[model samples]
Structures are given as C-alpha cells and as structure tokens.
Target: METIEKRKWSVNSVLLVLLFTLFGAFAVFPIVTLIIASFKPAQELMRFGLNLKIDPALFSFKNYAYLFTGESLYLTWYWNSLLISAVFTVLCLLLSSMVGYGLAVYQFRFRNLVFVLVLVMTMIPIEIIILPLYKLSITLNLINSMWGIILPFVVAPLPIFFFRQYASGLPRDFLDAARVDGCTELGTFFRIMMPLMAPAFSSMAILQALFSWNNFLWPLIVLRTNEQLTIPIGLATLLTPYGNNFDMLIAGAVLAILPILAVFLFFQKYFIEGMTAGGVKG
Candidate 1:
C-alpha cells in the first residue's frame, strides 16, 4: 500500500510539472515571436510575416539603430510614456488608497452609498463616459496636455474598490493604537496604516502602471502634438497612409515591454499576497 501511494504521488508530480510547462510555453510564445520579428528586416517581415524560426544570417540590429539614431521620434515616445505612467501610477495609488481607507475604517453618512457608486462606475466602460471626459478636458483647457490624460484617471474606481476591500481585512486595533500614541487622523493613515498596506499598494501600483502604459484611446484623443504622444499612440502613427514602419514598430514594442516587466518583477513578492488578503474580506 505504501509503494502504491508513492507511485501515485510521483505520477501527480509529473503531471503538475507537465501542466505548468505547457502554461509557461503558452505565455512565452508570443513574446518570443515578437523578439524574433524585431531582429528581421522590414522587407522580410512584410514578406514572410511573423514566425518563431530565427535565421541568424537574416537578423540585424538595423531596426533598433534606426529607432535610436533616425528622425523617427521613437525615444521621445518612450520618454513620454515613462513619465506619464510613473506620475499616473504614483498619484492613483495615493488618491485611491486614501479614498478606500476612509471608506473601510471611518463611519460617516453616505459611506455605503459612495462605495456603491464606485462599484457602479467600475461596471461602466471607459467607452461609455469618454464623451463627457473629453468635454470636461476641453472645459479645463487640458487638451493636448499630459495632465488631461493623467487627471481623468487619477482616482480610478477599481483601485479604490480593491484598496477598500484590502483595508477591511486590516485590524481596527492598529488605528486605535496609533491614535493612543498621539497620531492625528491623517497621521495615523499616512504613517501607521499605509505601511501595513504595502502589499495592497504594490499590487495596485503594478495594475495602475500597466493601465497608464497601455492606454491608447484616451491619449489619442487628448494629445495632438508629435512629441506629446505616448508610446502606444506614437507606435500607431508608424502605420500611416504614407509609410508602414514595421521594423521600428516591432522593435519599439519589444523595448516597451521592458519597463512593465521590471515593475512586475520588483513588486512580484507582494502581488499574490495582496490579492488574496483583499479577496478574503470581499
């Protein structure tokens, strides 16, 4: 019976390894394809399209060279994206987390109603309210500016909801203890409670960063100048009616993935913990 159990355990272990290998391959395939395509010349890409196979003789750094040295404005787009995403992520985390912590810990009239409004806002798509957002941006003279894009999404509803759920799981004793130690209401939240919610902040930071990085439609509407365009919008302009810069486009996309990957790796330790801790309360 012991020998049979050992065999069963070995079989299960093998199956789990195989399953995870398959999933890893599935996730890595597209990224591998993109990297390979970046090396190939534009003519080759136009002719053969994207394929996994690499030919060392055919691949070169010409695309990347052109991206950096040429008058393509690629680096401008990269810088713009980095700046906007960084600022947006920091602001969203601060504003949303505070709103969430307030809803979670404090008692006030219309607290539940405000939370319900956040939930309803999450259910609504950006496509639905973009018209109003555009009008508001125009009214505030934020058109053709980074602030237009950043301000509209700074207090994202989803992050607020997530933070609120996560904060709910935090002990009220921490708040009381901080108050007893002479911390003011704002001081307790900023100095005491905020540190305890590191995992939640890390998770939301990654999320909000990705959203700002990949945001295309809103940036497209707001930013008109070439230098002001984010990476997504700038990369899109490469496919104009006059020319199709497949080489630069593909290489730029691969380069763009680096920052996002770095952010994830940096905050990875807290990601799963944050999700699970918050989810338990909800």
Candidate 2:
C-alpha cells in the first residue's frame, strides 16, 4: 500500500514537471528569446529566434540605445499610450460600474430591456461601424484629433456587461442594510458597492487599458498626424518606404510590449479574482 501511494505521488510530480516544461518552451521561451534578441545586432536578428544558435558576442545594447536616443519617437509613443490607456480605463470603469450597479441593485421599468440592449450592443461588429464612424467624425470636424479616437471607445458596452455580471455575484442584502442605516442610494453605491467591486474593476481596467493602448484600426482611420498616433500606430509608422529599419522595428516592438506585460503581471491576482467572481470558476 505504501509503495503504491509513493508511485502515485511520483506520477503527479512528473506530470507537473512536464506541464511546466511545455509552457516554458512555448510561452516563457519566446519572451526570453525576444529579450535576448533585442540586444542582438541587426546582422544577427533574422536568425535570433528561439531555436537558433549564435555567439553571445554578437549581442549588444546598441539597438535599444539607438531606439531610446533623444531623436527617437519611442518615448513619445510610450507616453501617449500610457496617458490614453489610463484615461480610457478609468472612464470605462466609472461608466460601466455605475450602469452595472444600477441594473444589479435597482428594479426599474425597462430595466431588463436596457440590460438586454447593452448586451446586444456588445454583439455588434466593430468593423461594420468603421466607415460610418469615420464619416460622423468628419461631419463633427474631429479629423486628426485624439478625441476622434478616444470618444468612440469611451462607450464600451462589454465593460458594462462584465461589470453587471460581476455585480450579480455580490450580496443584495448589503444594499438593503445600507439603506436601513440611512444611506442614500448613490451613497450606498459609492461607499459600499463600488468598494466591493474592486476585483471586477481591476480586471476591466487591465483589459480596457490593453485595448486602448494597442488600438490600431480606429486610430488609423481618424488620426492623420504622426504626433497624435498611439503606440501600435506609431510602431507601424516605423515601417516606411525608405527602408524597413529591422533593428529599429524590433527595438520599437520590444519597447511597446513591455508596459502591457508589466500591467498584466502587476494586476494578475486581481484579474483572477474578477474572472472567478464573474463565474468562470477559474
């Protein structure tokens, strides 16, 4: 019996090790390769992938250094992305959380209809709206403006749906108890309910921030000036007809990805809680 138990334990340990090894090869290895490749000279980049063999002597920080030089636009792209993503995230959270909390807590006429409508809006294809949105932006004389890009994304329906779903998991008795203690409707929400929903906010913030930061297509339609371009668009601008500038392109890609990676890693715990709260059972 003891011998059988020991064999079961050994099997489980081996299985865990195999899972780790597989992910290390597929996920961790690619990131590690990219980090190493960023230091490699342009002469070695094409061959700097995960399985490639090369001398460590061929690696240098010149690629990163050149991209970070005073004349380079890398910092500008980073700054724009950070500012826009932060603003968009907060706005989306506030709007979605308010609407979601209202729907979750209140029973009003047309309440179910409104929730269904919001859910329906989430199903609308983003591509279908591109042309009409561009036309509307033109009519409103918002061409070449950051508002043209920011304003449209501000009405995020999916965030509303996600927040509403999360709100459903919260205890309704908390709101009733708050009211019994003389709390106003808005006060109960602001002080009690919103605080309880932090995990959901963190999850939505991570996702919305990533979307806003990496937003490419809408920016392409609305932003004409290089100065107003977001990170994704800015990175694409590096690919010009004059020459591709492989080293600079790779450098820019590395620079662009780091912040999003950092944000995800930072809020990973909250993301898990939010996903679990929303009933994924993760």
Q: After superposition, how far is residue 143 of candidate 2 from its true place, in Å?
A: 2.8
In model 2, the runs with Cα more than 4 Å from the true position are: 1-20, 46-54, 240-242, 273-282
Residue-level lDDT of model 1, residues 224-276, one tens digit each, is 99989999999998889988989889999999998778867777766555445
RMSD of each: 3.2, 3.6
TM-score of each: 0.89, 0.85
Off by over 4 Å in 1: 1-26, 269-281
Candidate 1: residue pairs that collide: none
Write candidate 2's Cα lDDT for 131-197 as tens digits: 9999999999888876788888786777777778778889989988999999998999999999999
Candidate 2 global lDDT: 0.79
The numbered model that scores best in lDDT is 1
Q: What is residue 242's positional error in candidate 1, in angstroms?
A: 5.4
**Candidate 1 local distance difference test against the native:** 0.88
